[model samples]
Target: MMYKKLFLLSGLVLSLILVGCEFTKKTVNNVNLFTIEDDINLGLQVSQEIANDPKQFPILKEKGNEDVYRYIRKITNKILNSGKVVNRNNFKWQVKIIDDIETLNAFATPGGYIYVYTGLIKYLDSEDQLAGVMGHEIAHADQRHSTKQMTKSGALDLLLSAAIGEKEAVKQVVGGIVGLRFSRTHETEADEYSVRYLCGTDYNAAGAAGFFKKIGGAGSPPEFLSTHPNPDNRVQEIEARAKGMGCRGNSTNKTEYNRIKGLL
Candidate 1:
């Protein structure tokens, strides 16, 4: 009877805790149990894991690759500093380059930790194209899509466990962030936001579609496509949206972009 009473007490405490800190839903579709602080903390934990796992991440050191880092960060900063993103100052907005030349992908952890593979840089034809891709990744984090997806996947129980100081529950949530495949609705939203973010800058607002256009022309699919599932007619849809939004500049900056690509 003692063990049963302890269980009841624990359950009562959890219920009381949740009553004060209930899981809230954003205006967006999914349920997001995490707060902004939670996103930042979780992202930092995942980033530490990536930093420790050199074999898988193989992050390029900034010492020898200062220029490359600067150029990429320039693109990232442009989008973050665009005054369009809501959590612009709240997130870290740091950039890292993964050394793999064959993996054409970039991703952002919640609270703005960005990672780009060297292959993605090399594969793109212009700086604007890279900016487009970066913008999309940024949108995913800014939209809090990862945590929303987690909440839908029955993470509320784990979060409640975490609330009671269960470290392992927190670790499980962190582990799941990296490999998440965003839904088509999230992908479309990211793409649209990418255009909006770049629209305020010099680059073509629809430059992300350029990545899709190039990939469509290629014989095999890119690793980026594996994680970021392309919606049907995505390229056309992005271009049309850019036009409808009256996005102005179309600077590809291919010459300077090519020079930087050689550095990779």
Candidate 2:
């Protein structure tokens, strides 16, 4: 009886490993064990958790902040309409504003749930710059970087537990995403995709480069830079790519952007 039980357990482990391998094989750029559906579910779950935790998230309510939400939606919609995002129609793509002026950062969850800090919105100079940041964050979701990072960090066991309907494991996975740090390679891909996404729009293709230039020239890194480390020649690379693509749109719409800024 003991020998038979050992054999069964070994078979189960092997099966799980094979399942993980299969999922990993299906990913686009890296070894991601989660499927697109998994990303949607996980992002939805994490976003709900964030919504409930007002002390931590402080999401600005759309009740009296209709204009702000509308402005954000306009920017987000332009990028989404650019036709470059994967799973664009399937993912939620909900945008939320976290009302914290001190934290200058923006992030997207696995399935296109984006949260931007007020500090980041206030800090940017023009509409195109904000659009650039939004595009980069959207790329992170479209590319499923969070799950890829989770796979790399040995969260396979946790994922397996979640697969087996372990509720606590799911919660842990969702909770662990509070401050997930993406790799430099993922960051670069996001940056490149930002330009690519913007290239399809009227916004400046190298708008993201402007943000990097400002922060790098400022000499003091904000929370955004801390998570997204500005490597050498990042600006040059972005500008060069935009120029190489021959993207003609250079409209920053600074006057209108300043008007929106005044509303906040």
| Number of backbone-clashing residue pairs for each candidate, in the order shown | 0, 0
Question: Candidate 1 lDDT, tens digit per residue, 1-264?
Answer: 433443344322332332122223334445576788877876776677678779889999999899999999889988987778989978888899999999888888877889999989999999888998899999989988776655544345554554344566545544455555566566777888999999988889998988988887454544234334453377888899999999997989899899889998
Which clashing pairs does model 1 show? none
Give me the runs in candidate 1 sitting further than 4 Å from their true place: 1-28, 157-175, 217-232
Cα lDDT listed for each candidate:
0.75, 0.76
Question: Largest lDDT belongs to which candidate?
Answer: 2
Give TM per candidate. Answer: 0.82, 0.82
Q: Where is model 2 more than 4 Å wrong at Cα?
A: 1-29, 159-175, 217-232
C-alpha RMSD by candidate, in order: 7.1, 6.6
Q: How far is candidate 2 from the true structure (C-alpha RMSD, Å)?
A: 6.6
